[model samples]
Target: MTVIGIAADFDPPHRGHAYLLDRARDLGDEVVVFLNADYTAHHTPPLLPYRLRREIVLELGADEVIPVRGYHQRFPLAYTVPVRVRLMAEEGVDVILDAGPSRNLDRLREHVERVLEVSDLFSIPPNVPARNVVRWLAAVEYVNRELGTDVELLLIPELEGYSGRKIRAALRRSGYSPDSLRKVRRHLPRETFKKLERYLKARTPPIARRKELLDVLNRASSYELCSIAHLNTIAVREILRGRPFRSERQVWGALRRADYGSVLTRLALANTECRVTSDEIARIALSWCVERLVPENQSPDSMYRRDWFVAALSSHGVKARDADRLYKRADSYEEARRLARRRYGVDPGVPRFETLIGEARVSDGEYRPAISANGRLGVVEDGFQELRATAFGATLLRYVLDDPFVDAVIRVEDEEARLIVFPGDSP
Candidate 1:
């Protein structure tokens, strides 16, 4: 009699597993399924234990199911490969039909003849209800090359309903008979159902901070400190680390000194150490910070506060055009200060620049607005107030310029620089 072998993680043996196995039974007289070991799934842990998963497979109509265990092996799948192959040979099976040409099946096929591979017959562009058709076809080609056999492979498109993980969860919670696999039925107990529901409710996708900068930035408090230049300097470093912040303070610290250009430059290097692109991280982080610190509800248009509009503009270095939309009502200094107090918790009359200068014992007449040769707005030298303002502008300015807008900026000798803006882009 022909013997067929199936290898799968079978994390929860849903309708898809049964659908594939039932088709395997039709092609061969006996079916042997090798369940993936618990440790084998370390890279991607399965929801259920291997033993229970094997039992679930049998209940779904697998003829013979076996536990294939190994420890301390570089390739555990490699060890189980030979064991299943020998079982096929000892059974005196002439022909073999496998669910798909997996690594273990390839090992078995190397020792056998008349190997048949059944794979994704139903897929898009040319076939039926499955998405991974081409992938299965590719696996068959790989097996054919390794085994040096003709390998009669059939592609079958089997339609299946219900995912294994959801089914496992449903059964455990309802305390229903696991045999209710064929259909959705009330087999689990009420208490089990409640517990399962609670467990599922608590289970959430891990917040991927390292995946994007925005993801990290969005989690910070509205009052978190931020800096565009800081982000630009450290974009590559943070992306390489790819770990979530332990506290709001950590995220706040991360928001320092970044701009779109610096982000683009760092990402352009494409260092293997940094898995994510610089732009992606910057965009995510910028968007996240903006969303919480300066939301649409608190936007210039929604709330006419000049200080807020100025602060937001300064933080991102927003131009008059962009700032105009956000704070259309703030046409004068009084309005700007009034809005600033409501939004930024700053007293517009407090005179931060004057206070800092007074503390430094600098004369007010010595406070001259520094100007660039290009005849554009420039930051003051030793104007500690300008340093703070520039830092704020570094956070809010929407444009990145070649000219530094701070108290002191590094420049290559005789290298003409562009006017630097915040968010690191030109208006």
Candidate 2:
């Protein structure tokens, strides 16, 4: 049997995902799919829990699906490729297909028959228009180029662009509206969606939770209503957002997780005509609120940036603790780019670092030194010297007091305990 293997996060398999699996099947006599375990996707939270998601893929037409655990303490995605390759090798895979941009193709090719890149067809051909083809493709190219690989791009114009991310967002919406569910169906394969609907029905909270919220909504402010209804204050505030529930669609953003019951309970309460399903609420929310990543004009100091990032995320409904993790990631991204530029004149477009990246918590105007490759801490002192970037105690200094025009080089020495930079230059 000619076995083919492919790996994906597949938190919830959508139409585009179905296309890839179909292609994988065409490439070999048998197909095996590697499902990324939940809690492994670094930046995004899973829409469904681990076991539920695994069950979802099993229904989505994967021939042989196996969920794998993470091996690395950090940078699991990078490490995931090796684990997949090893497992697939044992399964006698003839070709390991990589359709996504994010994967270590170079390393995988060494062990497998060959790492074959599947052409992602569809300018978003069917189901729903792609979430954002330009942005998603740019991210893809950046990853491949950073790793110095030339993966073939295939064009299958008939295949549609089905985004699981959009589908998941659509699911987290206000009252379960039939219209919303109808819209979602357009983007999902009929069989897959039918199964999904059945699963969603099972997950809806009982109606008792709805009646409790309705009574509280009748007489109290959102804050007071939480205590009266035994609901979480933050979710209630988010659902209300300081305004009365004027329309179900208008408030779907806040209603996504506002109640345990179906979103329709809130909708029905807003106006008794609501007869929606949980699936509809999600679809409406996705059509209304699109996710965008806007770069922050970050502070030079890392700790201050954390505060700024937290405040920004809080306003958009992310909790305080989760916001902290996001801030750390942003800081690490910036720090890597800054360090890489100072050392190697060329930028790889994305970062893969060896040093443990962290943000300094306090600002004392002291030059934050990076531990060199050889394990020596960098320091700045007053003297004239020059050295290599990766050397221990070797430093890159900027913004110092000196004769502004004298063109002085900051002295860096491996053996020196103190780093000396007579100010005047800015990096």
- How well does model 2 score by local distance difference test? 0.39
Error of 1 at 21 (Å): 2.6
TM-score of 1: 0.32
Candidate 1 Cα errors over 4 Å, as ranges: 39-43, 66-131, 165-427
Positional deviation of residue 247's Cα in model 1 after best superposition, in angstroms: 12
Worst 10 residues of 1 by lDDT: 351-360
lDDT of each: 0.37, 0.39
Highest-TM-score candidate: 2
Candidate 2 structure quality by residue, lDDT tens digits, 97-122: 64543344343232222111211111
Per-candidate clash tally: 52, 22
TM-scores of the candidates are: 0.32, 0.36
